[model samples]
Every structure is written in structure tokens, then in C-alpha cells.
Target: MTGAAERMRDRQMTDGMALNPAGPDLAEAMPPGVLREIEPRHLEEPRGRYHGHAGLLAAPHNVEEVAAVVRACAAARIGIVPLGGGTGLVGGQIMQDGPLPLLLSLERMHAVRDVYPQENVMIAEAGVTLQSARDAAKDSDRLFPLSLASQGSAQIGGVLSTNAGGVNALRYGTARALCLGIEAVLPDGSIMHDLKRLRKDNTGYDLRDLLIGAEGSLGIITAASLRLVPPPAANGVALIVVPDPAAALDLLSLAGRQLGDCVTAFELISGQGPRFQMEKMPDLRQPFDSAPDWMVLIEIGLPRGLEPDTALEALFEAAAEAGLALDGLIAQSGQQAADFWRLREEIPEANRLIGAISSHDISLPLSEVPGFIEDAGAMLADMGNMRINCFGHLGDGNLHYNVFPAKGRDRAEYDDIRKRIQASVHEMVVARGGSFSAEHGVGRLKVADLERWGDPARLQAMRAIKAALDPLGIMNPGAVLA
Candidate 1:
């Protein structure tokens, strides 16, 4: 389709559907407190990537209220953009160039509806923060294993919508596997009340899975029945120095064999990340006196009988004997473990402060990760003198490979080659049997990448599904499918 035609179609989908927050249409349709003017926080995404345009903001308190607002929007054929915690990195919460959409924020629906401790399940509303869900699980002596750096602000609805994968994904899996069922409002204003806390349900066409990672293009999730698990009685963390990515991978294999499933997290970090952290966020203490060229942060959670510290020590000894690790430090206390994690979690903030010219969240097969890293570095080195910070949940083969300016240089000077850098990295990733987009969903930022890298048949099927479910294209227009 031509660019003009696509723009016209997008605008026409919501033609004559202008929403005025003070107008009678929404004022009369929604309850008094549910409708309000768009606030500054609602207009901005976490990364400062995209500025959203919204004519109205709705904070529905219940599923019925959410359905009512959706019903009104469907009748008017106005687009709906769902907002949650406003912490997404890929601009999923922001609608930049579409007709002013109705921003649906589920902040008022923050509640832990029911907790079935016996079944290890909890039903939580969409607005419940990830940290809040974790706390609720702790109250029942269980664990909500979907942990993220933005857990304090990111809502459960947005987490599931993006199928977020975090550090614990190596052990418990992503958000999709943690969810039992979801309650959502379809594009046509119909509520899909399938929030059952069952282990298995073979009903036709698993709509629950469909909406989980749809990024609100298909529907707005109101609540979910989340799977919970037993909390490990003991946990340990260690930071180990490795010669390079290849050695790090070897260390991972040895540790996995020694610790088995108890290995919860295996993160790969570059010297640049620690240097940036020291420069930008000095409050968080660095584990090493000076940043090693490469390091891996390993975490393991174990039952009471299998002491975590002992297990971690055994793994470290084996890794060192195998020439995989040069040096290591095992956490002796809970505070020490938290300190190690702080260093890993704060790297993104440091990256933000340094200002990346281009950031790539890509994944490769476990065996191919080492070669890809080496080849990608060579590729970027040939392009420019840009510094690279490669780090992420190495256990799952996902890396947050980010590019920045050299020391004492500004990113604005490299703006002309940002797209080239991104394209080069993504191309290398694809050529090496890797995904261009991994845990982070393809929000507005990577839609073009999706089109370029996605399979032709898969893209066609996705477009067909979007058309069938939201014929009017009133749900997150100009997102994911272009």
C-alpha cells in the first residue's frame, strides 16, 4: 500500500470519532471519575522515545466499566490505546501519529481478587503492579516468578500483553507460561470472561494465549489468573570473571550441569556496562575493583536441604577448574545478594544516562550466542568508533546489545548512522538464526524491523487475524503490523 493510502485508511478508521474529554459523549457514557483529561505522564513513554496523542483518558475501576468505555469507543469507531505503568521501553504505550485515541489506564483496578494457595494460583486485576503480585504471593507463602527491573511500576496487564521475559524466565518461563487465563474486552466491546485457575483447559481456539502477547492490538486485558509456585528456601548469587563470551558460555554449561534446575539466572555483562554505571550511577557499588572485560552474574535458588551457598561454591570451583572462570565472589548474606543484583539491574539506567545511539534486544540460539557476539562486534567496529555494551539474561540467549558514543563524545554526533547501526546489528542477528526482537515486544519502535525480518506467511496471517478481530482497526493503529 502507498504511504498516503495507509495514512488515509488509518485516519478514516477513526473518522468522525473525535473524543472530547469534557464532551457529553464520554461524560454521559462513563462514570464521573472514570473520564478525565490526559495527564503529562500519560503522554510520555519510559524511554522518551515517542510522545503519545490522546484526546481522552479513562481509568476504569472494574471490568464492567472497562467494557462500557470500550463499547462506547467501538460505537464511535475511535481507536483505543491501553496504558499501564507507562514503563514500556519500545513505545507500545504511546500512539504518536494516529487520530487522538482514547487512552485506557487500568490503574483503578489494582486488586488481588483471590488467592488459591492450595492450587498455587492467584487472580489479580490488570493494574496490579508486578511487585504487588509478588508481595501477594509471598503473603500466601508462594512465589510469583515473573520478575523484572520495572516491576515496581509495570502492571500485570502490560507484562502479560508483551509476554515479558525477565531474569527468572530461565527457570519459570515468560509471562505467557505463568498465566492460566485472562479476562479481556474485545474490540467489539464483548467481555471474554475466561479467568479460570485451571492447570489445563482444552477449549477451542485458545483466546487467552492470543491476547496475552497481542500488545493490545487484539484486545484490552482487564485481569488474569496467574500461576504461582513454591518459594525456594535458600538463594545465592555470585559474580564471576570470564575471559570472553565463549568462556562465559562454557561457564554456563558447567554451572548448569553442576546445579541443574536450581540455576535461576545467568547474566552476561560487559566491561562497558560497569564503566557506564560507575560514571552515571556511582551510588551502586561495583563488585570488582575495576570492570573486567567480561563477567557473568549467576544466581541459584535451592530447597532447604541443598544449601544455595554450597551449591554455588561447587559450581564456581568446577568452572574455575575448567578454565571457564578466572575469579569469582559468592554472596554470603541476603544483603550481599541484593547488592549483586543492584549492579545488574542498574545497568539500563546507566545506559539511558549515557544515551544510546541505537539499542538492540535480540536473541540467538544458546550455541550460536558466542559467535554472534564476536561477529557483531567486528561488524560494528567496521562501521564506526561506537562503544558497545552487550548484556542481558544470557541463560535465555537474549542480549541487550546497545551502542553508544565513545568517551567524551555525544550521541547526537552519531545520529546520521543510527539506522545503519541498528540495521547492521539486526541483519547480523537474523543471519545467525537470531531474533531481532526478543523479550521486548515490537512496539512502534520496531514495527519496521518486524516487517523486514518477519516471515511473509506469518505476517499475512497476523494481518488477517487483526482484520478479523478488529475490523475497524480501532485498537492500537500503526502498531506491530504497520
Candidate 2:
């Protein structure tokens, strides 16, 4: 098909389409190797808490094939559920048994299309993993700061779609903030190429922003232009032992005032968390004693000309004088800094391996964090039997409120009580003028919660947009919205 003809056809598909749109013949769409090559390794899968909703699906290698497949599915009225890495904790990626959906993965679109170093932007296909983008940036003496534990396999599209916020959110911002523009395939197979490197543009509507955290409910992101930053010249890392969360908050304000924007990371690690990790991971050693109750993993990164060490030293000294920090250790080398960060990043994984957990990713007002911790901790304990590993971007007041039950308890049994626990936590969070979800987007896991607690007018507007863009509701139906 000619480019213009293809584009015209795409536009036509968007019109007069039923909620259950008719699709092309699926038999001819499949290439020979696409399904026939599924041998032993392809079929062999690990036995885990597998979501029975959606079954396994193949990844598309290129945009043309992916778009074609989606178009055909849309025509057939099959729900198109976009997948990437399949590492989503929420039930978003699960293929449910009813109204069977076609899972379209961008894993094969793993290509670095272009890197515009001069413009401080890079264009990568949807399937390009986060680690690959970071490597590309490093090669050009720039930095792509959107990072997380799943970066090794988490594709750019999924990250941006979910609007993932990782460790560096304090400075560089989240996936949404890092993105310049996106190129996505609409539900009708139309390519909305808004990929531009301009720093500022007030065109009609910023359509790219709609798709950023849409969780693939609107369209399938094909490629994106991501903003980059200059590599930090110096990194100062210090793990401070604080008396409690209140003191950690105090130290955060102190460091923020003293260090200004250079305070890149202010991570709160429960004293019990590190103790758990030390016990779990034999190779990882504990840096401090077990009596502090709460510890702060603070980081300060400066530009090339600034003296990071001197600035950090001053902050620590002031913190000590105020009795906010009990003791501290500064990482003098890169290896030591990595160790400090590992302690913070691996907490969730470490806790997961430990046993049962009813996790909550919530955010509250910065001033209310300390109180929320103290009060919520007691409340959770009062509810029944659970231990809370409360930590996260303390600077931003986001807390990963994970509830781990007593050891050896069956987590499946707690599933029935999941709603009650979530309601308790969410009620407390909302009372503090906080959000139910902080970093993670409202995937299938939180859809009902979103409907209940979400602002009605806001939901109406979102539904209007969804109806306009994907009237068929074939793109990730029952996700983010009911």
C-alpha cells in the first residue's frame, strides 16, 4: 500500500466502527514462523501465581506488523491488550477468559531509531528496553535518568504508558516528565506522530500527555522522543541513621534548604527493612546497627563545577547539630554509593521474597508523611496481624505502604481480606489529602478503587476522551476505567 493510501485507510477505520468492530481474516494475518516456531522453550513456562485472565501472546517485531495485527483485531471486535515485558504487578496485562483479548507486545520493536544529542532528545521504538536507552545516552555523554528495578526488560512504551517514577524522581522527574513527545498507533491503526524535539510547543492540545499515563487504554505507543540531561559530575551518597520518620522528615527539609535542588534522592528505609535485607541476602552487609528505627538514604548530586562533598558535609553537620540524625556514613567511592542505593532499591524485592504482603503505593502531603507513618503503623497493627515496611521518595511524600503478614502464613488466605486492608489504608491516605496511587498508574488492580475514590467530574472527562479516541473500547478494556 502507498504511504498516503495507508494513512487514508487508517483514518477511515476510525469512522463508523461498532464497539465490537469487524476485523480482517485472522488466518491469513499470521506469518509462517509466527506460530509454527513455538517449540519447547516457547511453551515451557514457570509455574507461579499465573493470571488466568489472558494467556500468553507473541511480541511484534515491527510497527507495520503490530499495527496490522491491531487493525485486524479491532475490526474483529477483539480487545487489544498491549503488553511489554509482562512485569506488571497489577492485573493489567492478564488476559481474562471472557471476551478474549488479543495481547499485542512491543518486545520486538526494540530499536533505538535515532539519538539527537544536539537536541537533547532520543527517539526509540516502543519495545526498546530502559537499560538500552541508558546505555545509548552514556555512549553520547548524556544521561537518561528514568530508572527502576525492571529497567533490564521494561520497555520504553510500557514505562511511559504507566508513567513510571523511579529513584531519580526527586531531580529528573518521572517517565512523563522525561518524555518530549510520543508516536502511537491509535485504536483504528492510525499513527499519531507527535514526536517532536521542541522544548516548548502550544499546539492545539498536548495529545502526547493523554497517552503518557493512559496505560494503553487509548492507543498503542510505537515510539517516543525522550528528553535527556547532562550527566552529573559528582554524586555524594550518605546513609543516615535517624530516630524516626519525623526526624527523617526534618533532615529532608534541612538538606533541601541547604543543598537546594542538588538533593537528588531522599529515600527512607525502615530500620527493619535493612535488617530484613541483611538477613535475606547473605552477600549484602548491613552498614549500621539495628536500633535506629528508621534510616534515611540521602543522595546529593551536583553539576561539574560545584563541590558535592563540601555541600553534603555541611548538610550532615547541621543535621547532627539539630539531633535529627543520630549517625551517618558517607560513600567515598562509586562502589559504596551503589551499595547504599542497592539497600534502598532492593527493599521491595527483598520483602516480597520474605513472605505474604498486601502492598499499597500511596502518596500524602509532604508535611503529613511522618504522622501518617506513626498513626497508620499503629492502625495496621491494630487491624489484625501485619508488619508495615513504610518507605519510598520521602522528599515527595510518596510511601510504599506494604503490609507483610506473619511468617509462614498463606498469602492466598489473606486475598479475601485484601479489600478491607486496602480500604483502611486508602481511607487514611485520603483523609491526609493523599493519593491512593503514587507512581503506579491505575491498572486493572485499582480500577474499582479509582471509580469509587476518583473525582466524578475528572472521571467523566477521562471517559469522554476515551470514548472519543477509542469508542470501540477495544484498547485495553476494563483498565484504568470500568
Candidate 3:
């Protein structure tokens, strides 16, 4: 009897054959050399979870294998959809309505190339898991701080491509800031080796910055050199309930002003978000007995020889005295801190289980967060009985504006309002001098919206760069620039 992988592969081929009855299937159309390079079973078989536009195509092991596939697709004028952990919420990894693209997966190219603790750099292959890299750094007594909800599955390539922002961004910065250099395979199969680990090299154009947030539209990243830091001696975590988003902002200001660089994390949570966790996670309990409209998760790290408790206590006292903090829950131990963070990190999963909702990941000037919250929340509440979960990197003013349907409403009915909700929220974002797309890159999901609202000159320049680098348009087509 065939194993599960074989069965999945066979099922995919059967589906592909059924979908393309008149033409040759994906496996049948593969070039001769490329076909031999890929295992026959892997081509017509599914190796992992397949979703979005481009489904299961082929899995590549190294840079050469990936380049070979891209070269073959380029010669044949076929689109190439690059897949990693497939954890993108904006449909970034999905294939779209266009040329039946060849899916180039980097799942097999995982390797830790080099670790330089002295130089503060770690070179990892594209397929290396975020947690794996972090662990490697930890083993060396260093710190690799790029993190997210799906770090277990999301690869370095996808994270860099999307420029992911996580909890620690308030201290260390986003993925773009953490990445020093990259080794990528261009659309036409040429290798662009700019993986230099140095801090300053102002030679010419910053190619690394371009590829970091390109969303696979320009090239496929194979390896990367990331910046690492020294681990903190101790951590201080607090779960504070605030009266509103405004108070959270004031508390954030206090943390920034008083603690300076020690303020490592400043995240916001809504009552609905935590309530969902309490209902779904079962073991999760509200840290405070009474629920507030908004909550703040603050984390600070102490230097060697310094105590965290004293500093944290003093900060909390200041916040309470200033009337910015209502009530708070300080984690008594590291495990308790982990438990508190798990609740914040699992919000997306909780929302996913609930069903389709209009989600917006937008950013604004940090000071404007409170106004945006009031206006957007009031406007959305007036629409109907929809449930809104407004929370995220409050220190950065990036809110994940998610709206759920009224109780007992069918998913299909709620999904129909997605476009309307997006337009309204995006308009609010633009009105407040904010960005429509923040950490999450403009994948196929937001192409039309980007086209409509994106600055004309910037769009033209991006198109020109795309045409300059990928004239054949073989790189992950129908993404970002589209």
C-alpha cells in the first residue's frame, strides 16, 4: 500500500489532470533535465499543505535546484510561485488567476550555513525555520530575534520576503532591520550573491532591502545573513488592563520615556481577542477578573547585574499614578510569562477558527492610533452587530483591524462584505496619513487595492524595477506589483 505522501501526490496529480484536461499537466510539462532533478513522486504528489493560487508544484532542495526550475519555467514563459511555510494570511503564497504557474518550494533547502557569534551574524539557508535559527543563536549564547505567530512553520525566506514584524520590534526592530544580506536566485536563474555580513557597505543600490519585501516578485531568496544580539539576563512581563486605546498609548509613552531602550515589547489586546482565547483555548484565563476594552502587554529586559522586578514595579507605579493603567497582572515566573504571551500570539488562530472576517493590517503615526481607534471602531460598530478585534503593535501604531459577522450569520454572507469593509478601513487609514499595507506585503490579495491607492510615481518605479530585473515576468507573478 502507498504511504500518505504518495497518496497525497497522486491526489494532486489527479486534481491537476482533472483541472487541465485539454493541456499537459504540471508534471507532464516539466523540462527534461528539471524533471530528472525532481523526484517523480514529488512532482505529481503533495509534500505539504497546499492552498491559495499556486498549489502543489515541485519541491527543490538547494539553490541550484531552485534556479534550474526557475530557468526552465522562464524559458517556457511559465509563471513561478515560490512557496515556504504557507503561513501568509494575505494569500501571498497562493497562485492566482493567471498562467498556470510552477510552484517552486524552498522547504527542502534548510541548512545552517554559518554562525559567527563574534561577528554578530548567522548565515542560514532560506528553508531554515525561524525557531531553528533562534535556537542556533541561543546555543551560541547569542540572540536571533525575528519572531511571529507561525515561527514554527514559517521559513526565513518567506519571513524576509514579507518583512515580518513581531513582538520584539519595539526593541530590536522588524525583519528588514534584522537582515544584513541575502543570497537569492533571480527570475532568469542568475544568482545574486550579496550575502555580506558587515554593517556598512554603501557601495551602490541596496539590493538586500529590495528582495526583503519583494514578496517573491523580483527573486527567490535561497540564503540570508541575519543580525543577532546578546541575550538579556532577565525578563519582566506585565498584563495591564487599560480603560481604552488612548490610555494604552499614554502608558506606551511612559514606557518609552522612562525605560528608554529597555522597553522591549508593547502590544495591545482587545477584550474580544482575549475572550475568544478563553472560549477556544480552554486553559487560558483572563489575567484580570474584569475585562477592559483594551489591554497592554509590556515586556522589559534587565541588563546583567540589574534586577527586573524593581524597575518593573517602579514603572507600574508610575503608570498607575498617572491614571494610564487600571489594573495589571505581572507574571510571577518565566512559565507564566510564556503562558501570557501564548494568548497574545494565538489570536490569529482563534480568529481563523471562527471563520471569514474582514482583516486589515495597517500602520499609522504612533500618536494617531487613539484617534484612528475611536473613529474606525465607531464607524464599524454603527454598520451592524459585527464584532471588532482592534489590537496589535501599539508602540508602532500597527493595528490588525478584524471584524467578525453578527451571531448566527452564514460565512458566505459575511465574506460578501469583505470588499466594502476593506475599502472603508483603508480609506480611514489613508485619511489618517497611514499605510494600507504595513508589515504584511502586498501579495495577490491586495494587488487591486494597492493599484488604486498606491502612489503613481512609486508604482511606476516599482514596475520599472520589475521590468528591469525580470523582463519575462517569470518571478512569482501576480504578486506585489500587480
Candidate 4:
């Protein structure tokens, strides 16, 4: 079945049709103000990894308009790569080496269709940015907890499509858990309007889940009914110096025992990230005079009367007594809290400036994380004198373990060993029963890794499902699957 599906997709690709920028096919089919000239930004993705091939850009103002564009692409046998905010780290939003696809941008469709404060739900168009959704939820006295560094630019549809996991995932869960139902345009341009606010609906096959993290291989999500929660009465942030990753794990256990689910985010940071920031972006405020060997950014949101500062202080004291934490500073004001978060958020930008030889977003079982880190570091050290920046949501077992060159050296110097380093790190992760790709979906960049490490039975099932849903393979072709 999979072989036949692949042949069918290949046959469709051979159908003589070219995506012309000024062609009448798109101009005649799209609604006024929807079709626009493709810009350089539309063809580029974050990380400067992939430069997509998009001849024309279309910003649909409504779901019907999106359907019309999809229908036109289907009829023309052209590929459709859905674009949203252009902030995805993965190459999912970009078609780097394929036929010039119809870049379907959802920017114009940004809208909060409805907000039900009582039901703790908000129906938002896919074009709505994550920050916009969070702001709207706050205005309605609710919380949309899918928080990420790229929240300002990442749209809801893209977030749902990748099933993004951020710091708050330790408490609130990822995009999949936050979404109730979604309205989408299928590969055949048919509308799947299943946007319900219900908490429980065991009706039939979960098409919503299927489309959420499929990277648009199955369909293009138009809008979603997002799950919201009551805003925490009191929240505080603290930066604590930890001895090492093992100590960080110990502190995490202590915090969970003390605060339980009130612990919103527990991030592990290495001295390398801070040092890089200080070198590249000294203008940003640093929480400490010097970068410590390791630190943990702990955030807690407590109910009314359970003072967050007091709870954090107690946790700190307990952690210190347990030898898990050395020293810590808790934010006294909102500005201070924001300052602490700013430092954490700016590390990625700093990494970009330094230029990494190889970067990995991996997750390990809670118990295996410390061991994997130690073993991986030793393995890399054996290969070369490389600097490693290991950091991420420790509470969730996800780490952005990146490798770079030694002092005064460029990453290009280590070009020969980039693939070896990535493979070594990923092999350690998988051997320890972890995942090579955690929060980031298997976009075009990681399709090879997925094929290499993905379970055979699971991969087979995914291909079959893709064939069943997107037989022509027009929806984000060559994304999750090769």
C-alpha cells in the first residue's frame, strides 16, 4: 500500500504544471486582496536553514478563501505549503527544494472569533499569533498557557500543527493538550469544521489529533477552539544556581514535592549560554555578575493566599539544604521577573550569533537525563575540543544540546564532524530511551533522522495515513515523511 501511494504521489509530480508567479490560474481563482507577490521573507525560515521555493503568496482572509486556494492547487496538481508567522525552527513552513508551491499565508485571517470565559475556551483564527491569543485570554481573565520565545510571531495554527512545547508545558502541557477542536481545510480542499468547545467528546476517529502535529501533511488548520485556564492568583520567578544537571534534577524533584503542579516552569541553563550572551549581546541585563557553572530558572504560580514568593523561598531553602541548589535570587517585582525571563529568552539569539556546528532538541527519560548529558559530553570531548551549550525545560526532560567550535574558531572549522556529532548525540539519546526530536516536529530537516530512528511499524502506519488523507501529497509535501 505504501509503495503504491508513493508511486501515485510520484506520478502526480510528473503532471506537467508549473507555479507561475503572475499566472492567471491563481489570480483568477483567489479572492481579491488574497493573492500577493511573494516576498523574500515568505521564502525564508528561521535559523537561516532553508530558503523555500514559493512563486506566489496568498493570504486568505477567511476559511472559504483558504479552501478556494487549496482547491485551485489540487486541480492544478501543485503543492501547497501553509505559511504562518514564519517563525518555525523546523523547515516545515518552507519548501526548500521542491516544486514552487503556493505559499498560503494566514496573516490576514488573524481574529479571535469568540471567547468564552465561563467555558475557558477561545476560538481563534490560525493566523492569530500566540502572543495575541495570550493577550486576548488575559483580557477575558483567562490564561492560554502555550508560551514560547517566538510567541510574538508564531501563529496558533503553526503552533498547533507542530504541537509546540514550551516552558509552561511542565504544568499546562503542549499545543495538543491546549486545543479542544480545530477547523481545517483537508488536502482535497474540503472543510472539516469540528471546532467544538466541549471538554469530552468520544464520538469517533480523532481527526483533530491527526492534523495537530502532522506538519500540514494531512490538512491545513484554519482555526482552533483553544483550551484556557484561570489565571494564577500569584506568580513569581527565581534564578537558582545549581551544581550540575544531576543537582538540577534533585532540585526539580524537591520543587515538585513542595509545590506540586504550581511549579509552572523549571529551566536548566548552562554557563556557556550566558557566556555567549554576554559576549554577543552585552546590552541585555544579566542576572549575575558572572555566569555560574549551572543555574535553574524556577517559576511558580500559586493560588490566592499561597504567596508565591514565600513558596519559592521555602523551595529554595529545602533545595539548598539538600545540596541541590547553592544560591538563588527571587524576583521582587514584575519588571524584575520580566528581566529574568529576558535573559533566558535571549540565549537563542546569542546562539544564532555564535553559529553552531550542530544543534539538537532532544528529550530523555527523567532518570536518564543526567547520565546522557555526562556521557554525551565525554563523547564529544573525545572527538574535539568543542564547547557545548546544554539548556532547556528541565522539568519536561527536553534539552537544546548544541555543539560549537573552540575559542576564536568558527563553526565552519568543524564542518567535517557536524554529522558525526549529531549522530553521536542522537544515538546516546535513543539508546537511553529518549527522543531525538522533542518539541520540534519532523520537518524537512529531520525527515532523514525520523526515517533512521523512527519505529518501523509506526513509520509504516504514518505513511499509510498520509496516503489515505493526502493522496496527491500536495499538502506540505516532503515534510514529516520523505
Tell me the TM-score of each prediction against the true structure: 0.96, 0.90, 0.89, 0.96
Candidate 4 residue 87 Cα shift, in angstroms, is 0.8
Model 4: worst 10 consecutive residues (lDDT sum) = 1-10
Q: Which stretches of candidate 2 lie over 4 Å from their true place?
A: 1-25, 30-50, 53-58, 407-416
lDDT of each: 0.88, 0.77, 0.78, 0.89
| lDDT per residue as tens, model 2, 74-143 | 6676677787766666656653434445667687788898888888899999988999999998888889
Predicted structure 1, TM vs. truth: 0.96
lDDT of 3 by residue, 1-482 (tens): 11322332353345442122112445554444333233332222121222434433667777777777777676666677777777776666765354356777787788999999999999999999999999999999999987787788889999999999987888899999999999999988888888999999999999999999999989999999999999889888988888888889888888878878988889999998877676566676557665577889888987888777777778889999999887888889998899889878888877776654688899999888889988987888777668888779987778888888766774567666677888999999998899988888787667777878888999999988987898766676667765
**Candidate 3: segments with Cα more than 4 A from true spot:** 1-56
Among residues 3 or more apart in sequence or in different chains, the pairs in candidate 3 whose N, CA or C atoms overlap within 3 Å are 9-45, 9-46, 53-94, 53-95, 54-95
Candidate 4 local Cα displacement, residue 251, angstroms: 0.9
Steric clash pairs (candidate 4): none
Q: Residue 260 of model 3: what lDDT?
A: 88
In the range 1-482, model 1's lDDT, one tens digit per residue, is: 43432653555546543322223565567656788777899989877877877778899999998988888888776778899898888888887764577889999999999999999999999999999999999999999999999999999999999999999998999999999999999998899999998887897899999999899999999999999999999888999999999999998888778888988999999999999998988877888889999999999888888888788788888888888889999999889999999999999999999999999999999889999889888988998888999999999999999999989899999989999999999998998889998998997788888888899999999988987898777787766777
> What would the TM-score be for candidate 2 when compared with the true structure?
0.90
Please list the residue runs of candidate 4 whose C-alpha ends up more than 4 Å from where it truly belongs after superposition.
1-24
Clashes of 1: 0
